[model samples]
Target chain A: NAGVTQTPKFRILKIGQSMTLQCAQDMNHNYMYWYRQDPGMGLKLIYYSVGAGITDKGEVPNGYNVSRSTTEDFPLRLELAAPSQTSVYFCASRGTGGADTQYFGPGTRLTVL
Target chain B: DQQVKQNSPSLSVQEGRISILNCDYTNSMFDYFLWYKKYPAEGPTFLISISSIKDKNEDGRFTVFLNKSAKHLSLHIVPSQPGDSAVYFCAGGKDTGRRALTFGSGTRLQVQP
Candidate 1:
């Protein structure tokens, strides 16, 4: 399986601009997550979805939005991107059941100026 | 508060030597713990995980030890090789609910030849 895949390995956006970070998984995972890692810092979850139609906010959900319309896809939207949003974003997924190991994609490196 | 912490920012070990990485957590509700390895410009990959029920889990050259009473966990790599160098992240999560993992700042390991 291709596992999880993300688009635009790198991108730079101007302040106030908006874009979507696309994520998809071939593993048919029931849960998907979005996380951002700053330099010298641990990853903080931005959002997560339990299924296609259910989504929830995470630790750092400000300036971002997400939707899971299918079992294989979860997309993250950054509206009015700010300089603070310049960081590496990772997408991950896990199969049904709690405590399942999450598989992560290669990640998208985003820079907001 | 930082629920999970990997205090050491970096560690180096000689080739074919053992490398030990440590993690401490503050949350007693965290019943599942995981370790992930990441290379530069890549996403973190799942390495190994241990549940509260089991104190240890082994996979090939990697072993994870859990000390639930002390809220501590560790990862041990035997015969560390150059290819084993990467940033290791410790994450903890609850076994129930939609609660996601809280990751610690990664520890960078360099296996020198």
Candidate 2:
């Protein structure tokens, strides 16, 4: 299985611009998450989905949105991107079991100027 | 507030030596702790995990120890190899609800051969 995969390995956006970060998992996980890691900072959850059509805000959800329309896909949208949004974004997925191990994608490096 | 913290930004160890990485969490609600390792340009991968009920868990050359009194957890790698060089992240989470993990800033380990 390809496990989890994220599109746009690297991207740079101007202030006020908008874009979507795409994520997909072949494992058919019931949970998917979006997280951003700033330089010298830990990864903070932006949004997550328990299942298709079920999304929730996380630790840092400002300036971002997410939707899980299918069990295999979860996409993150950034409206009016700001410099503060510059960071490495990671996508992860996990099964519904009690185990806390989340499989992560290669991640997308995003820069907003 | 930062729920999870990895105080050391980086660590270096000689080949065949032992490497110990530490993590602390502020929330007592966190019952599950995990460690992830990431290579440059790659996403983080699951290394090991420990539950609150267990004081330690071992897998191959890696071991995780949890000290509930101190609200601390650690990962130990015996006979560290150059191939083990990577950024290690420690995370904590609750077993109930959505089970979202709070991650540390990460510690870059350089295994010198």
Candidate 3:
């Protein structure tokens, strides 16, 4: 089974443009997260969802929004792309139980010009 | 400020040697520490983890040592192999109902065979 899948392996966007990064997991996990990694930097959490219909902001949630419509899908939306938002975006999922290991998807690389 | 820190930007080790990756955190509220490994163009994968109550945890060829008083942790990989070369990230989790992770800037590890 595909544990976690992310769409748009690479993308380029102009300033003020908007796009959505698609993420889906087949593991039926209740916890899903969106994170962005800048060059030579660690991943920073953007937004997270504990379950469908519930979403919350994370450390770096300034220019992004998230929606968890179903147990399988959690998409990240960039309202107004900026140069600072050019980074690799990763999606991860984990079970609801205590300290479950997180499974990550192949990241989406976005370049904002 | 970055709560977690990986001071070394990169490390090089010969095949069959030991590779040690260090991480320190400024937050005492973090009760769990984890290590993730990432290759180019791929998302980070969970490698090993240790709880505050445990001083050390071993998984096959990898070992994680945690020093709660020092707010430091390390990953030791014995007999380092060429395939083990990648960026290693240190992450911490604070269990305040939400298992959110804070990551440090990764340390790139190069193993020469």
Top DockQ hit: 2
Which parts of model 2 are misplaced by more than 4 Å?
none
Candidate 1 local Cα displacement, residue A29, angstroms: 0.9
* Model 3 backbone overlap count: 0
Candidate 3 backbone collisions, by pair = none
Residues B1-113 of candidate 1 have per-residue lDDT tens digits of 89999999999999999999999999888878999999998899999999888999999999999998898999999989999999999999776666578999999999999
User: How does each model score on lDDT?
Assistant: 0.94, 0.93, 0.93
lDDT of 2 by residue, B40-62 (tens): 89999999999888999999999
- The single-chain TM-score for chain B of candidate 3 is 0.97
Error of 1 at A87 (Å): 0.4
Docking class of 2: high
- Please report, as a residue range, the 10-residue window in candidate 2 chain A with the lowest summed lDDT: A92-101
Residue B6 of model 1: what lDDT? 96
Comparing 2 with 3 on DockQ, the higher-scoring candidate is 2
